[model samples]
Target: MTGISGGGVMTERKKKYGGLRSGQTIAICLAGLATLWISSGAVTQTPDKGAEESRAARGDQKILVRVRESVSQVRQSYVTVFGRTEAVKKVNIAAETEGQVIARNIMKGAWIKKGQAILQIAMNDRGAHLSDAEAKFEYQRLAYASATKLSKKQFQSRIRVAEVLSNFESAKSELAEIRLDIHRTTVRAPINGYIETFPVGVGDYLQTGEIVATVVNLNPIRVVAHVSEREVTKLRVGDKARILLAEGVKREGEIKYVARIGEQETRTFRVEVWFSNSKKVIPEGLTAELKLKTARKHAHKVSPAVLTLNDEGIIGVKAVNKDKSVIFYPVQIMEDTNEGVWLIGLPPRLTIITVGQEFVQVGQTVRTSRDEVELKGNSTDFNSVKSAS
Candidate 1:
């Protein structure tokens, strides 16, 4: 019985020893798993740190771009407006006396001179009336002379002589009225111009103040334009202007008149520019464009491709500062030419980004390559630009 009891106690001791070994094995496996997890995290973090360092290095590098140095110069500005040609003088000739249009001398579209006869009226009883008036005037003159002689010799009373003088005056007035009526029978052109319309035929009877013909004086033709209120202030009488006609003809003119009042519907002012058309090449009612030169200003000329818009939709161009950092300059376009556009509101001396402007942003440091020949002729004349009409 004692040997069996000792064997049972030995078995119990072995079970406890086996249980402690199993617990130690589990702890060792858990320790190995924690070490592997920590090593994997370090491997992932090393790559991420390298990537962040690489991005920082790239950020410090400067973007390369091409630049051109531009200098501002005086440039003449102009205000362009569209309008039409008109005659300097237009007249509707009217008859001054009632008469029959017995003879037609001028035809429509014929150029006539001042005081040229346009129509002739019949003399209907006018000759007879003049002869009768002359005889009565002659008789009255003789009677008045005889009466004055008698009064001077004190052979006639003063009241009787005055009554005889009144009769003579009445006869003279009647004779003068008949002569004046005969002179107005012929209708004449008041000015030199082309006859635009002749409504009456040879037999047509015309009353006083009736239209005889329509005449238009085309020489020294005028260009009429309605200028905006904003632009009207820049114009004045006698200012020089350039005109472009619809048929590609160009002309020079002088501003003849400018209205002090504004048109109600369009809010514009009327302007008239006179151009010499001695050859009568410019006809009335031809569409034209007027370019009125204004004050000269300091401006820069650059290609339109360099123009860009900002976040707020402001038109500007990208340039480089003294520190080689990118900047934005707001610009106003003064004129557009075939070569480029003139820009105002920029610095007198400027460095513009000619290339790679889209890749860089404002306030970014950049590397620039100077284009020595980009800006040629700093003193370019404003007239060199082609007319953009």
Candidate 2:
């Protein structure tokens, strides 16, 4: 019995030892799996090297835009205003005395010289009156002589002789007045001009101060134009100007007068310009354009593309400063040419942006380059620019 019990005890100890060995083996396997997993993760992971290389390549391949600087001539022209053509001298021919129109030889559109008889009045009665006046004057002279002899010889009373002389003189004066009234029946033109209208015909009984015709002198024409009060200071008498007629005909003229007072309603001063119409091409009542030469100024010529608007809606060009900062300058357009526009209120030399101007904003720093090379040392060449029609 003791031997069997000892053998059982040995068997139990063997089973316990085998169970301990199996637990050790399981722990070792778990530790090995954990190490293998960590190593595999480290080998597969990367530091996004491809993305970094792509960013570096992009930075190095960035493009740099080039530009140039150039000088150009810019012309300054004043503002133009519309005006109407007027004659320097205009007159309405009218008769001074009332009479019958016995003859109407002159026709409309006839150029008549000064003192030319345009219409004749019937003077038959007038001539008769003059003849009667002469006869009365002779009779008065004979009567007065007789009165004087009678008074001198003491043959007649002094009062009676005086009364007779007075009666003869009165009759002669009445006849003379009748003759003078008859002589003022003819209608004549006062100046040399073309007849615009003829309102009388033969046998037409006209009253005194009645219009016979309308005449106009067109040798030196006058143009009446209104200028703004703001621009009045720039205008002066004798300033040179150009008048553009309705048919695009150009004529040289000078400022004749500038009104001191302004029109109440328009607040604009009236200006008169005189132009010679030797060809008579500019007719009355035709519209004309007046360009008064105000001043001459030096300005910069820039492309129209570079012009932009600011937040306040002011039109200007973008320029770059020495520190590469952007600056927007408001400019007045002095003139516009075919190639571009002439701008005022800029430095004589400027760094204007030709490209990327629209993308950039005022006060922003940007890389800049000269747009064009200077053709001359100091002088500007504007021959390439065409005149704006």
Candidate with the greatest lDDT versus the true structure: 1
Candidate 2 residue runs with Cα over 4 Å from true position = 1-77, 138-183, 295-298, 337-340, 364-369, 373-389
Model 1 per-residue lDDT tens digits across residues 1-389: 99999999999999999899999999999999989988888435435888777566555556667799999989999999999999998999988888788999978999999999999978899999999999998998998899899999999889988888898898899899988888788888989999999999888888999998999999999999999999888887988999999768999999999999999998999999999999997899999999997789999999998898888999989999999999999999999989899999999998999766766779988777776644333222111211110
lDDT of 1 at 12: 100
Pairs with backbone N, CA or C atoms under 3 Å apart (clashes), candidate 2:
67-370, 68-370, 68-371, 68-372, 69-371, 69-372
Query: Pairing residues by index, what is the TM-score of model 2?
Result: 0.68
Q: List the residue pairs that clash in candidate 1.
A: none
Best of the candidates, TM-score: 1
TM agreement with the true structure for every prediction: 0.76, 0.68
lDDT of 2 at 95: 80
Q: Model 2, range 112-131, lDDT digits (tens) per residue? A: 88888888877756777788
